[model samples]
Every structure is written in C-alpha cells, then in structure tokens.
Target: MSQLELRGIRIQLRSQSSPLIELPELTIQQGEIVVLMGPSGSGKSSLLHWLVGDSLPEFDCSGEIRVGGVRVDALPTQARRIGLRMQQPWLFPHLTVRENLQCAQRGTETPAERARQLQACLDAFGIAHLSEQAPDVMSGGQAARVALARAILNQPAVMLLDEPFSSLDTATREEVRAWTFAQLARQGLPTLLVTHDIQDIPEHAQVIYV
Candidate 1:
C-alpha cells in the first residue's frame, strides 16, 4: 500500500523571515484522510503545492516528500505521483465529459482496454449517463464528479483535496463529500484534505490545525 510522508516541511514567502507553516513530519497512510484545517492564508494550500513540487517561486519551501517510501520532492509537478482536486472543477470548456477524462489517462493499454477503463471510472463516479454531455451543461455536482473521475484516471499515489466541496450547495456538498471520501478510501489512496469548515471533517479522520 502506498503512503504519503512529509518530513521537515516549512514554507515562507521569500521576503518573510517567519515561516507560514512548519512541521517536523506527517504521514498519511493508505485509505486514510487527514484533514488540514485552518483559516484562509494559513498556508494549507501552499503546503500541498510544495508536496506536488509546484510551489510558487515567490515562496521558499523545504520538505522531503515521499510516497510509499520513495522520495519524490526533487521531481517536477508532472513527475510526482500526486492528484489534486480544487474547488473549481477546471474542466476543459470544449471537451465532453468523456473526452476530459480520456485525456487524464496514460498507459500502453490497447484502445479497447482504455475505453473500458474510462467507462468504469465514469460509472463509479455515477457520471456514465453524462459521458457525452459538455461541462457547461452539467450541474455543479456533476461537473465536480467528472473532475474527480479525471483525477482518479491519472492513478496518483497520493490525493490532495483543496476544499473541493466548498462550491456546491449544502445538499450537493454533503453528498459529494461522502462519495469522494468513500471512493478515495476504496482506492487505498493516502489523502490530505484542506478545508476551513469543521463540517467538512469526516468521522474518525485525523485533523491537523495549521
């Protein structure tokens, strides 16, 4: 099972002497969700970016990021096996739901296998019926599911969620939040969720205050 490890994490703006966030170490085990809770500007998102190796140049970050015991902090964003889902779905405007997901998958599998895999992911997200629909035509929840499907198709070792449910209506937010956590757990992903809302915390989840 793959686990995510962060060691000696520290982040600060280049012009600032005080660090915004500092942690000696943190570990997210397989099938676990660790919620990072803090108000806005608390460096929750910055920490995630550092783990993915995409921290803004204006920020000074130092950390040892590892996945399944393999160090990956030195890798580029695309090379690090990390999945990120933000508040916005960020789907390509012109692509159909199916097409958007298709672009995230990469493998040497045959065409038929690839199609099957894509279809399975869509079904798991409860979005198979909307496969041919455009993102513009879908509800906020539907679009979010498609975005998550695309992320899952990428098959990352660790998942990072930056308030992914914050944009949805209350009902939709509750439903989608449950589904997302369940799905990620089923995949045995080491997940770190960043959110300011206490309601977003799942039962039994490990929460860290920033």
Candidate 2:
C-alpha cells in the first residue's frame, strides 16, 4: 500500500497579493518516487513545505497530508515522520558526520542497536571514514552525502526532497540521485522530489507539473 497521500490539497500564501499553491491531489505509493516540477515562484517549494507540516504562518493551508495512513496535517513537523532534504544539505556545522547521523536514528530499542544502524548507514553511503570529520572540513559533495545519510537514518515513512542535488556538478548530481533513489527503494519508503531540473527525475517517477 502507499505510505503517503495528499488528497484535495490546497495552499495559499496570505500575501496582500495572491494564492501560492493550487495542488488538487497527489499520491505516492510505497517505494515510489513522485517528481514535482515547475519554474521558480511557481509554488514547488511551497507544496513541499505544506506536505511536511512546515507551511509558513503567512500561508493558509487546507488539505490532508497522510503518512502511513495517518493524517499528519495537524501534527507538528517533528511528528510527521517525513524526512526532508534540501539543496543546502543543512548539516550541523558543530557536529561530526557520525554525530549528525546518530542523532537521526529512530525506533531502535537500545543504544547499541542504534549505534549499529548508524554505522551501517555510514558504510552504505561510503562515508564510514568521514565519521570523525567536521562538516566544515568535508567537500560539498561529501557534506551532501552526509546530510542524505542523516535524513534516511531515521527510517522515515516518507521522504521529501527539495532540489537536493542542485549544488552538485553534473556527474556528481547523477551519482547522488541514483544513490538516493536506490536507498529509498531499499527502505521501501515513498518519496516526493521537488526540482526544476528534468534530469533529476528517475525513470519510473510520476511527474506533477505545477
């Protein structure tokens, strides 16, 4: 069954000007990837913001955001169980790569199990050696990888990506996109990817143009 669903979703930024988003309905099945594409200011980011319960106070939202069959619109952002990856990576500058990943681990019954999960994730992302490295010391691509590893370490029911590869060069972008999709598939988690770049859309992605 699909882990994420948006039904009759509509959002409007309370501008002195006009509405920001007009999405009607969107659904993502388990392990599926849905790509949202539009030009800048077309509300792509706004839609993602609403899905994860981060709709700005200046925005008015009327919709149902469901994750694993649970309505999450009324829930706090931390309770949504949705992992979000933005273009800037958003890793904590003060923490080492391992600490960032460790902080995101979820559902483990014991500290040893959580540590094992974190170590496995770092190994899978090919960043096991970076465990002790500070964010500022890593290259851009490496930092982005760490950010993604952290986001998935929580084993979210769904994942939301906002132009996550925009900072990478062409080759690196493709590599990371493939890595991300593969990881999501392995986790059996539905994903909503928001990006203006068409190349970022994977082969099986269902595209929504806003």
Candidate 3:
C-alpha cells in the first residue's frame, strides 16, 4: 500500500504573475480515494498533471510529489507509474479494445503473462466479448470502462481521475461510478478524483475542497 503526498505545491499559468494554486500539503491515504472539488477554471486538472509528471512547461510547477518513499516529481512521466483518466477516453482509433489494454502494459513479464493480464482486465470489465471491436464501435460506457482498464494496466503507484464519470448519462454514470469505486478499493491504491459534482463523491472518500 502506498500514499500519495504533495508538499508546498504551486502552479502559475503562462505569463501570469500569480500562482493559480498554492497548496501547502495534501496527502492521500493508502487504498482511499480523495475527491477534489472546485470550479472549472481552478486548476484542478493542472494539479493532477503535475503529480503525474505530464504538466506542460507553460505552467511553472513547484512541489514535491511522493509515492510511499519515492519522489515521483523527479521522475519522468513513463517512470512515475501514476495512472490518469480523464473526461475523454482517447482510445486509439486504430487499436482494438484488447490491443489498447495490452499496449498500455510496461511488460517486464513474459508475453504470455502479459496476455493473461490483458484477458483478466477484459473479463473484469465484461468486455472480453468485445475484445476485438474498435473503440468507436463500443458504447460510451464500454469505452469508459475500456479506458479505465487500460489506465489500470499501466500499473501506477497512484491514480488520478479528472471528471471520469461526468460524460456519461445518468444510468451509465451510476454504473461506472460504482464499478470504479469497487475496483479502486479492490486494487488498494491511493486515488485523487476531481469532479465538480458533489454527488460523485462516494461516502468513504476524503474530500479536498479547493
């Protein structure tokens, strides 16, 4: 189990003198989801980007991001092992569902083991039947689940979710949200979820009002 910690975080947009966000300390406990609430332009997504080592150079970042004892802010995006899901699935148009998940794996394991892990994610998402289908052919909910599975297969030390369920319809949102929380709980990873809607905050999650 690992905790995600941020210390003395600050970010300034391009040409802006003032920092948009100035956070002194934020720590997400192991196996818990921390819900981040703020208005649309409050730099919530930018904060997540900084943590995952994906923030643009246009935004000056100052902070220490740590997962367990390792300083992830010093690592490159690929080496950070921090998973991120966004409003858009952004599944590759050319890749099939199974291939999308398989390609996301940083396979130190044998090919057979990697394939097995892919199959497991497929079965877990109930998308094993749709494994060969293109992402465009799937429904919105399927696409979201597939994208989430791919993110999980990335095998991060922590996960960042930015309005992950906001794009879905009412029924689909409820379904995906429940499934997502269950999966996150089962995986036992620290997760930071950013959403404007209060209803999206699960009962067990910690709320960080920004």
Q: Which predicted model would earn the best lDDT?
A: 1
User: In model 1, how large is the Cα lDDT of residue 27?
Assistant: 95
Q: What TM-score does each of the candidates earn?
A: 0.97, 0.93, 0.95
Write model 1 residue lDDT over 21-117, tens digit each, in one string.
9989999999999999999998899888778877589899997999999899898887788999987999998999989998998777899999999
Ranking by lDDT: 1, 3, 2
TM-score between candidate 2 and the true structure? 0.93
Better of 1 and 3 by lDDT: 1
Candidate 2 lDDT tens digits, 38-125: 8888777877877777747877778888887889889998789888898798888899999888778765459888887888888998
When summed lDDT is taken over every stretch of 10 residues in candidate 3, the lowest stretch is: 49-58
Q: Clashing residue pairs, candidate 1? A: none
- The C-alpha local distance difference test score for the whole of candidate 3 amounts to 0.88
Question: Which digits, one per residue and each the tens of the lDDT, describe model 3 over residues 132-185?
Answer: 999988989999989888999888879999999988999999999998888888
The number of clashing residue pairs in each candidate reads: 0, 0, 0
Scored by CA lDDT, what does every candidate get? 0.90, 0.84, 0.88
